[model samples]
Target: MAFLELKNIYKSYFLGKEEFPVLKGINLDFELGDFVSILGESGGGKSTLMNIIGGLDRAFSGEVLLAGQKLNHSKEASLNKYRRETIGYIYQSYNLIPHLNVLDNVALALDMTTLTASERKKRALDLLEQVGLQDHVKKYPKQLSGGQKQRVAIARALASDPQVIIADEPTGALDSQNTEEVLALLNKIAAEGRLVITVTHSQHVADSGTRIVRLADGKIISDQRLKPAYNAKVESKLQSRKLPLVTSMRNAFKHFKYHFKRNLLIIIGTAVGLFSVITFNGLGTGVKGYVNEQINSLVNPKQVLVTPYVKSSNNNQRSSYVNLTAGDKTVNTFSNKDIAALKQVKNVTKVEKIHTLSNVATSFNKKSTNITTVTNWTSVLNASSIKKGRLPKTGEIVIDKKNIAKSLTNNPNSLIGKTITLTYTGLNKSGQKATITIKVKVVGLTESSGSSQINAIGGNTIENALKAANMSTDVAALGVSASSMNTAKKVAKNINKLKVSGKLRFTATAVSSMLDRIETYISLITNVLAGIAGISLLVSALMIIVTMYMSVSDRTKEIGILRALGESKRDIRRLFTSESILLGIFSATFATIIALAVQSLANSALSQIAHYSFIQISLSNIISAFIISIVISLLAAILPARHAASLNPIDALAGE
Candidate 1:
């Protein structure tokens, strides 16, 4: 049986909706160790015949058998395996991988083989030696002569120890001497008990083959055998070929190196957008946390604040209120009746009713400091911590740590039990001064609450001193606390109702609403800033798409070559898609690092300004940014990969 056979093969194509037959019925057979050459004119479909035989094209309707197994109409995967393991192909154009050195280029076929790196390297070197390219192993294709490049291509084809070697005008680009050398190599291949077939237009090449098959317009017109020509020396030389294994990795590394700069630029560009997104989200989280902490720090978690509402005594008076003045027509700011009513609410607990007096001054040793005074001693003292001494009694004073540290030249402990004279000037009774010579012991010293104070004075002690000095007049505001926040709020509502009924002149409801409005405005500003930052992400997506499209175009010839080397269309698509996916991964990783750096800088700046700690990035934000980047990259790569896979191999090769 013949080692290879083609029977009644026919191939056709459509030209403007008209069927154009490229190959008519054809039959051929080849035995092992046969050197056959098919000579044809241009446009005679000689290349197409070689493509069909090499499994690069399967548009023909025919039966092709190799080693007694049918090759025609087989599954694509099976054909790919056959091409990978059974046949070696040499193209006239060399088709060396531009990025790889000669040795790596030659070892490309053996990448999928079960050979070790050393084994693949050894085989590639041996093949290069056989083809007389041993000295050019480290040189890229562009640096080598046409003959040397073709020799490398031949070495590549032979890397897998294929049974049949198919040469499509293999020596067409070589000089006369180089052509002779290549032709002699092909003849030597056949002498090693392998089938060598060549498609050519050269009479010299045709005459060199043991058998000649002539094709005219895609049909075989002659099949003739020439005189036996065998070379035992060449056979022995060719059969001595051996391969090393490391060349596959070297090829992959060369490919990566060639494309590294462009890919790195793409990665960095993508990372910029991801960094913005991550940083913004991180800042939001950090700011929100800070706000919550500040609020919680100032207010007790179990406490609720309540305010009073005022109503006008007369309809005529309400009409006179054209503008909302500070002192309204009527409302009891902190009536004792309201406090009594609040004590009746459900879950009622100890409630502290206190009034504030602002801008009261205390004089000691001819130095005076301004302070705010609160009326309640027991409830206020119980809720706060005294850093030193104890809560003040009626005749004692409690000062803040700041006042002790800043004003007192003597020991704070000695000053604690010392007497200080008090003087108060009433807000209502302007220019009226009141003085009280009270022999008061200094008691507790505290850190300033909610707001800072330049001097120390306890809420209860200040109010008592004012009263003693006959400076007590109107109450500024009130503080209320209950067993729980819910109970406190209920009591507060009741107090508001009492203020409305009593028609007092002060109300606390306005202050609470003002604070709420401030919070709402801050939230609005944050959202606006976030929305603006989000626009950059969309731009990043477009950038990814453009980059991937450029990559597809740049690697078109490479994709075609892989397809011609028996890679399936799926494999071609996957290669491009994988490259894009890897780009996304790299971008996201770098972007996360950039975001963290920005966060650190932001935190440092905020700490210096606010005297507190802050964080501007969070793990969740990083995760979200990565997910968005990956999705954008995958979406961007889809169209480019499809376009790459759909490319016509013939056009791609021709363009190259």
Candidate 2:
């Protein structure tokens, strides 16, 4: 049986709905140690025929048998294996990877092999020596002469130890001297018990072969054989150029090195975008944590607050006010009836009513300020904390640290136990002036609601004076200690019903309303920030698209070369996408690092400056940031990858 056989091959192409046949019933056969040259004019299907035979193109009707094993049309794996292990190819353009040295170029064919790295290196070097390129083993293709590059290509082909070497105008781009040299090398390769076939239009190349086949319009027109002496010289030369190993790992390294710089830049760009996403997410998370901490610290965790709501004439202008006076000029105030109704509700563990009076003034040697304070609930059950003194008892008062400090013209520490005179206005009885001056011991000081000590004292002290003035106050506004949240809500509802019936101006705690307002504000802020960040991510996606598009354009020729060298369409697609995936991964990793660093620095600085040990960052924020960054990167790469995979090899090669 012939060592390599193509039996009755036919191939065609289709343009739109039109069929175009390129090859018609072409039969070819080659035996071991035979140098066969196929010559044809341009557009005569020579390259297509070679491609079909080399398993690079499969759109044909034919049976290719190598060593008597029939090539199966139904199994893609079989054809791939044939390409991988049974055939070696050489091209006119050298097809040397620009980033690879001579040794790596040759070893590329053996990447999928089981040989150790050192063994593969040695094998590649040996082939380089056979091709007369051993001295250029460490040099990149761009550094070598055209002839040297073609020699590297030849060495790569031979490295596979295939049964056949298919050369498509291998010397077409060479100088006359290099052409002769490469032709001589091919002649020598066939002689070493291998089948060597060259597709060429040059008579000089055909004459050098032991047998020549000429084709016209895809059909063999002439077949001729040279003298036996021609065969003997070719055989002897091939013997001198024999290499022991067929494949090496240099290709993988070459591929990575060639693309490293560009890929690294892509990775860094992606990392920047990812970093923004991660950092912002971290900030949001940290803010949320801080807010939650503040809320918990400020409010009673087990207590639920309820405020009253009153409907105004216009639904849009709901009021918290109630009218108390009647007979044309109505007055608003909580009546005894409203309080009794609230007390009747279940879960009445302990209920305290609060009355707020504003615009109350306090004076310490003519330095006076107005304040707002709540009365009716002054004991421990109503107060949260006192920094220095106790809550006010009968005829006694607890002053704010800031007010004490301002009154004493020093820190509150100096006036903690000092007696301060407070003048209250609006006393109701005759002969008892609205202003009553009273001496009270400064008991304990308490922190204001996120207010400075001075402001807290000023505001609370003024409020205390207003509370003592007997001025009318808004009632049932603050409810403390519910039997349960549900009971408190029910009591609040009953109070509302009573005020409505009595036509009274009264307010009660509406827990749900307050919660709804708080939640709405939080959601609005969160969504707004997230939406802005999302828009930025869209821009980032566009940036990735531009980057990948540029990369595809830059590597078009390289991609074409790979496609031409027996790599399938799927392999080409995978290579580009893998590069994209690597970029995305790197970006996510870098972004996470940046976010963590920022979080750490900000948290440390804020903690030191605030002097309040309340804010903290959670692990969930870091994890969430990382995940969001990765997701964004992957989302950004999709379009670019698709654009790359959709490129046609021919157009890409032609720079179209």
Candidate 3:
């Protein structure tokens, strides 16, 4: 049985409906160790026959039996496997990948196998050494001369240890000296017990082989035996292995590094979108924090404010005028029952029944003035807020320093121990109206803001004054203080939900809740801004797609070389997709680092005025940015990757 048998092969081409026959019933037999040269002129079917024999063109009616096994032309997988394991093609153009060095280009064929990375590299180097181009293994195709490039191509073809080498016009572009060198290499390859089939138009080239088969007008015209086949000195054997995913990723990375400057610009464009999203989110966080700090400074976080739930019917000015008249039992107020109920709320450390007087007349040594409002002390004021004296005791008051200086005395500190007269109309316990007068000593002076006045009397002092003035000491609302801010918020939520006598009697309020609402609004606005910025990311994704498509176009021949080396379509897709993912990762990381640096710089500049570090970026936000960027980039690469994978190997090699 022949080593390779082409039994009655027939092939043709069609332009629309017109047929052009290329091969006409050609039958050939080739054995191991035979160097057969198919010599023919232009327009003959020598190349077409070579394409079929090399497993490149399977669209033909034929029995391609290798060692008695018929090649199945209808099954693409079978053709690929046969091509990968049995045949090596040497093209006239050399067809080396421009981006890859000589060593990596040679290693391309071995990547389809299970060999370790180091082993594949070692074997490729060994092949280069055998071709006498060992020192040029690290040089790219453009860096090498025509002779050296052809030698590298020969080394690549032999990297997988195929049994048959099909050379199509192998020496067509070579000078006489290089042609002799390549012919000597082919003769050596045939002597190693493998078939060497060369297709050429030169009779001089055909004479170097052991046999010459001449074709004319798509038919074999003559066959001549030049010499007996050489005996094998050593027969090469293949230890086939499967390609690892890492190999493809490494190859993809090399392509990226080859065009690092161009790819860096795309990555930076993508990073701009990521930076905007991350920075805006961080700014929202910082603004909320600043607002919360201001709120916490004004009002105690541990204090929950309580107000009466005035229904619409009693919320008119008539109800307010009645309360000021001091006999307003009709005003909705919390009774002892309500106060007791509030005291039982969870996390309530203490509950104080607060009282207030509006439009109160006060006299300091006959310097009389009507105070707009007066409040009794509660847990809301911290001790540090009192600038001069301590908190008010019974029958004592604490007024703002500015109020004392403006209203009663020129020296505010000197009035801290002086007596002041307060007169107001109120309601007694019996719900009757009367006038009240009380003399209280000032015990503290607080730092006042420009917006409001501050005058706080002791809770007991205000209650006693109201009691003696025939005014009902009915409490306005219960002031509840919790153990912590978080506990206060939780307690406030529960208290606002409480109903007394089947009607909601009180509403709970906290500084934290107001800050939370502000934070929520800020977040919504930030997200809107970030979303607008995200539109630029779509443009960046388009850039990536365009870049990848350009890469596919630029590396069309490289893609062809890989496919010809037995790379599946899936492998080709992975190669392009991996580059996209790498771009995403690089851009995301770069953007995150830039965002952090900006946050640090901005925080430093703002803290000098605000007295706090306000900018913050959370770990989850950083991770989310990375994931979103990568997902978008990978999605953009799908079309280009698929297009690259679907390129025809023959046509791709023929492209520039």
Candidate 4:
């Protein structure tokens, strides 16, 4: 049996119902080390027969046998392996990938083999030296002469260690001198141990080979022989495999580097969108932190102020139940029973009955000030808010600077040691107003907070003063304390659910609740801003899709060359997707850099005034952005990669 044989092969093309026969019942046999030429004129089905034998066209009826084992041309995967392991093609136009250097072009086919990277490179270098293009290894196809290009093509064909070499007009585009060189190389390839087949119409080219088979009108007309075939010794061959992902990524990076100027613009455009999202998210986090800090400085974060449940006219829930004057007839004071109920709340460390008086007339050393509001001191007050002196003790009063500093004394702290007479009306336990006049020592001065109640007296002092007049000791408000800010909020939430006689009894307000509303607003704003940023990302993704499609159009011939060199459709698709993923990665990297720079600059500037970092890009944000970029780009390349993969090798090779 022949080492390679084609039996009863037939092929045709269709124009609707009409048929044009290209090959009619062809039979041939090949042995190792035979330099055979298939000679024919144009449109004589010479190329058609070559396509069938090369596994590029599987629609032909034929039995291709290698070593008595029949080849299944109809099975695509088997055909791909067959071509990769058994055949090498040298095209008339050279068909070298323009972007690849001579050495890389040769090594391209080796990517399909199960060769180590170092081994593939070494073999490719050895093959280039063999073809006498060692000096031009770094030169691209466009930089080489016709002869150099053909030599590169020869080296690439032999790189995969194929058993048979098929030269489709190997010397058709070369000068006479170059033609002689290329033909000599093909002859040497056959002489070594491989079957070398050349297709040509020139009789001179045909006579150069060891054997010639003439074809006309799709039929073999004559056969001639110039010499006997050489005997080849058995040797190891390169095994074939699918293109590896790392190799695909490397190729993608090469292409990405090749067109850096164009791709840089894409990266910047995509980065802008990602930058916007990162900035907004970071800004939201910072804004929330700043607001929480400011409010925390004014009140104790772990303390909640509870008041009678007073629903506003718009039904907005009231924040506090503190009353400053006996004129506030609307509020029901907290009895010992009510305070006990609040103490039962979970997570509550302790609870204190809160009392306050409004319109308190104070006379201190002949200088009188009408204190607009006064409340019993509790943990609900932030100690930092005390601008001077300490918190009020049992017999001491802390007066706010609002009225006391200007109207009562030159220095507010000076009044801290003075004895002040306080005259005010308080509600008795029966809910009737009673007049009270008392002397209290001023121990502390507080900042002029714009709240309704700013003056604070010790809780015991106020309760004792009320009892001295036989007035109501019952308090209008309660202050509940918890371990932490989070726990305080939880306790407040539970406090709102507290019921007296099955009726909602109290309304609780914690500084954290205000922070919650602030954060919610910031989050909603951030998400809106991020969504707006996503629109740009969508545009960037579309840009990637369009770019990949244009690449498919531009590299059509390169795709064909790879297919002819034994690459499967899956390999071709992965090649394009790999490039897209690279684009995505580069874009995300650029975005992260841009976001970080802006974060630093913005925080530096904003911190001078706000004393806070207003932009905080997290590591997770950067990572998530990269993942999003890669995923979007990969999805964008799907249709284009599939389109490139589906291209017919014959048609693509013939593409301009």
Best by TM-score: 4
Q: List the residue pairs that clash in candidate 4.
A: 307-321, 324-357, 324-358, 428-472
Error of 1 at 54 (Å): 1.8
Q: Which residue window of length 10 is worst by lDDT in model 4? A: 445-454
In candidate 1, which residue ranges exceed 4 Å CA deviation? 72-75, 116-126, 129-135, 227-256, 309-350, 372-530, 596-607, 613-615
Estimate the TM-score of every prediction.
0.76, 0.75, 0.83, 0.88
Off by over 4 Å in 3: 233-236, 296-303, 312-331, 344-349, 355-477, 481-503, 510-512
Query: CA lDDT of 113 in candidate 1?
Result: 72
Query: How does model 3 fare in lDDT?
Result: 0.83
In angstroms, how far off is 478's CA in candidate 1?
A: 7.0
TM-score (C-alpha) between model 1 and the true structure: 0.76
Cα lDDT for residue 464, candidate 3: 80
The weakest ten consecutive residues by lDDT in model 3 span: 316-325
TM-score of model 3 (CA atoms): 0.83
Ranking by lDDT: 4, 3, 1, 2
Q: Give model 3 RMSD, 1 decimal.
A: 5.3
lDDT of 4: 0.86
Residues 1-656 of candidate 1: C-alpha lDDT, one tens digit per residue: 88788888898889899998888988988887888998999889888888778777777898889878897545877776767676788889987778778887787777657676698799899999988888888988999988888888888888877778899899899999999989888988888777888999998999998999999988889988995634332121122111222332343345545888877877788788778777766665666666654544333434434444433457533221212125554433455665566566555565554544445555566766555652335342332545578766666666665654346535555666777654444432344755444345567665543564323344455555556556544343444555664445455444444433556322323223333555576557665676676677677678768877786677677776766665666666666666666677778999999888877777788776675546567678778877887888788878887888888765666555
RMSD of each: 6.8, 6.7, 5.3, 4.2
